[model samples]
Target: MKKTLPAYLGISFVWFSAHFGGGFASGRQIVAFFLNHQWTSLFMPAFSMLIMGLTFYFSMVIAAKFNTYDYSTWSKKVYGNLAPVMAPVFEIMFNALLVLVTAVAFATGGSTLAKAFGTPYMLNTVVLAAVIFVLTIYGADLVRKSATVVSLILIACIFIIYVPNIIYFFPKIIHNFAAVKSGEIVTGTQNSFLDTIWWAAKYGALQCCAIGAYIVHAQACPDKASLKKAAIVGFFINTVVMYLSYFGILAFVDQGVLKEAVPSLFVVMNGVGGAWMTVLISLCIVIGAVSTGVALVYGTTNRLANFFGRNMSEEERAAKRKIHCISSSAMLVIACWMVAQLGLIPLIGKGYGNIGWVSLLLLTVPILLRGLGLWRFAEDVPGKVAAE
Candidate 1:
């Protein structure tokens, strides 16, 4: 079961697609965290890469060595007596957040399609939900494989649309930076350097909940070396795509033309290919949303089944899981549709902003402490003698 590089990349693509959902795909997060800060935001990509790389590596290692794949077991192993208290808290918050974000994806994708094709927004939402439901039913392996292809296509399409914009707009971007430094542009609330660093750290920490299951999936790796390498590769791929999109957004900051709900689409629509490019960009956004929504639903369903199906026979468990998946998917779609009516910005700001801090305290801290050897649990490591 020694995993090859392609095997690692395939999983990494899943990790990337899962995370690159509503906020990242839509360019709203980049605007809030990075683009708003202008040139000072350049450092975020590197800082994010560091935190996520370490987190992914350790998460995979712990899952492999401990034989715990789900977050409930992993948290218990890391938190000890606090597992009862911490596990439910993490599960409830994480699952709810996943539902909220998936809703955002549906809203985002639906709106984009509506603008592009003049289709009814609710119709688009229904279509998006159906696509995610089908994908979730096929389960993780299919999602991972399909995501690999989608991620590659996204990267290619993004670069084709944005790289030239970066070159053509480089001068304007530099000028805008100068204006901001001179206090002439009035770019609104500005974060101090330290504040920017903290935001990057917190954002990276929040991603652990989203990708934790994928790390669990990484347990298929035959050895520690393969797992570590896969994590690193995955981290780099995510980082690179993030920065490329950031730069794309940055290029348009000076012109003040990025006022649309989907700023990335605005960028493409105004760039080389014009209207045709917007259609292609719209497709990318929808696919990104679908990938993200499917991952969230799959993760939520998997967690619930693992939590409640512990005593069921294998056949019984499978039957119950199917029921759970279908019901959860329907619930998520309805909830998300209701929430989407409130708009994307509010959903992301309120939902993610609050959870980010909790994750830092509960999820990230315990895992980091265990991974760094600063804390150890007697029963955490599987296959080890109690005395050892």
Candidate 2:
């Protein structure tokens, strides 16, 4: 039952698509978290790779071993008696924040389109939400396959935007690299090297909650060894994307263009092949946002359905899941439209920055403890849950 290399690649692509939302694709996350730090930005990829790789490996191992693919059951295994108390709190906070972030991504993508082609923001939002809603309703397999296809195109577009610039701007970037200094503030706060490390680690950990459902659903690898390979492969893919994005932004920092809201777009507008390339990169950004939006919405609905349908008959459960998906998607689209009115920068700073740090303690710490063998589950634990 071991998954083949292609299976792992497909799962990894889904994970990458889900995790790399509008913030990342727009270069805002890179500018705020890494590029603002000057030369220290170079260290983020390794730190992110370590934290995210371990998180994925352990989460998948737990999912496969315990047959607890939903967050509620997974929390029970991790937190024991605290599961009842933590489940609702974590669920509300995690899903709400994810929805808010995703909504902002959609809004940003819409606004980007509006700027590009004079399209109406409302129309763009409707089209984006509709696409995600339809894709999610088809469920995880479709989401995974759609994400893989989108991710491949996304990677290609990113290289087209960044690689040539990195080559052409090589000397200028090198000359400006050491001249750049630390102490540049990002998101209204200054970050030292240690702060950057903390931010990277926390961001990676926060992703645990966001990607939990996908990791659970991607249990194609039946054995620990194969699962580990999938996680490693996923990590590499993620790290490469991060590296390219970070350096792509860093390559043009001396131009002062990083000050823009969408630094990657600014870079493409200035450095890449211009109008046509801008349109292509813009399409890539919208696709990335859509991929992330679908994943979050689907994951949130799946969690809700599993929680409410826990004791239902199989037929009833199936019916309830359909209802939950439709209702939740509709509600999410409306709520996201409203919240996105608050704008993109505030959402990323206020929403992700605070919630991300909290997840480090709630999700990452416990999972790391278990992975390190410092914590143990009872031998009968899996059987007890399975029997229930």
Candidate 3:
């Protein structure tokens, strides 16, 4: 069966959410960096999502051209050796990021647990991690399916409220940003949008594998041409989702309250409505947290298995993959528990938020450089050979 647009769209949105959860969900990381006081943050995620759309388009172009199982070969073929290392090196950093996320999930999840059960958040985190770890070890299909399902719930929750109000929200955000620009209501950062773009460069660690879905899509695509098509469709779907999510949350929230979390968008979201809306969003978030957690563990597992596959037989390689999945999940859960024990919100914001931008920049550079590098170095080779 031909791949449907909805399938690709769902994949793209899930990946973006999986990668940029802390930022995109509540505008915690990117929103704050870009919007700051008034309206700047309000407009930029919309634009950034558009850029993401382009990145998605290009990813397909590059992937199909290379036709490789792992992007490392794509990079190596293009850049010699440098590009091969970009993605995998980053994947290894999961140990640190997992701890951070586990902490936030527990910290925030704790409050929800408390209201719901009068329980400590730390205890809830351990329970959640145990479940996530086990499910992730079982298989990739399970986690991938879970991510899509949870992401849909998230998109629905945002749209249920925002889509109808878009015509209204845009004008207010624009007015607020205008006022901030003119020093009218002390809104939007003086140069908040610019700051967000600059800051997004270094913010990838928190969201490192958020783009794993892109890689997965690229690898599994039937051909390079089909991959580009997938990327194009995927990009728009994701951007639209981000745009709706950005404005939707802002409609019910203000900057001062958002600052309380010191870079958490969910904290802002916690106040996005009355009892029903609150319950709806909160439920979506819990599911989202689970979906993302599962994605992280799975992405890390596959990348590791591929990285070490050269020495193993096909059967050995497949067996190794299972070990990677199971062991990594357990290790990550342990790390999360450790972070939860120490507390993790502020650390994630300050540290992980910065690395995200770097990843974006790093990801594309090899593609550009490797192609150019090969061109420049072509003359030095013993004989001219066609490109891979």
Candidate 4:
């Protein structure tokens, strides 16, 4: 069956695409993280690419080798009760992160449609949220297909708009390169490595590791070799896409102005790419946003059903299920939308990274403890894994 073509890679790409969106969707994140340094943003993604690549290998490798999809089982065996104890915290973090992502999708989608046409933000928001809910209730195949299409669209738009621009800015790129190499220019974002690590932790990278592992377990890969291959492939694909996205933003926007917007990639892109292309990518961004909402909510709902021992509803029982589902969906959307509307950019800015930390602390600690010869102290607890 071609083993489903590694759904995790496609998921990772869509997931990482969320991280690379927002302010970093333009050049701001790159400017903050690597442009301040030498040729590092160029190299930073690669460095992460390498570390994540190795870590991913181990994740799928271990899970697949065990033939056990219950990540909790692995976690407990690796970290004793500590892994089990941390489950609630990880879920809370994930829920909060999902709430926030949903908000971003709604707000961004509304803003884009409002900007492009005379659409009411609320109406646009309602339309988008409804779409997100439908997509979520349906599941991942729709999301993967949607994301694959949207990612391709944005990727094409980025190339068409930014490649020549980068070539044009080659001189500035060189000057920035020499300055960073010579340590002559510091855009003065200190603790940048720690910042990115902290950033990676707070946001999706670390969380995505867990998510990736979950997907691996869900898909029921039967061997360490298969699992590791999946993780490596997933991370490698994600990092490349993220880095390409970073440069695309840089090539198209002025870094100085990008610093001010802080969270809106569109302000930067719309300015540089011409209003029409800006409008086009904005719609694409909104589409990607919907894809994200679909992916997260779909994953979350399935996870929740598994958590609560709920079966997939069939027939008229689905009516009650529908109520339950809509309640959950509404709660998430409204809360996130409120946050988005209230200008919680500063607060939610680290949402992804914070959740990432929780995921890393729970998952990585267990693996490291086990891998580093500390396994005897742990226990194997019951865990459930489902990819249905």
Candidate 1 Cα outliers beyond 4 Å, as residue runs: 1-5, 181-184, 257-259, 314-338, 341-345, 380-388
Q: Which candidate comes out best when scored by TM-score?
A: 2
Clashes of each: 0, 0, 25, 6
Candidate with the larger lDDT of 1 and 4: 1
Q: Judged by lDDT against the true structure, how good is candidate 1?
A: 0.73
TM-score of each model, paired residue for residue: 0.89, 0.90, 0.76, 0.74
Candidate 2 collision pairs: none
The lDDT of each candidate is 0.73, 0.73, 0.53, 0.53
TM-score of 3: 0.76
Candidate 3 lDDT trough over 10 residues, lowest sum = 379-388
For residues 230-325, write the lDDT of model 4, one tens digit per residue. Answer: 556656655665665555444433345335443234433444456666665565567756766666666565554333335555554445654655
RMSD, candidate 2, Å: 3.4
Tell me the TM-score of model 1.
0.89
Quote the lDDT for 280 in model 1.
Answer: 80
User: lDDT score, residue 311, model 4?
Assistant: 58
1 or 4: which has the higher TM-score?
Answer: 1
Summarize candidate 2's per-residue lDDT along 271-349 as a digit string, tens digits: 8688887888788778888988887777766766676778999899887787876776677666776676666646466
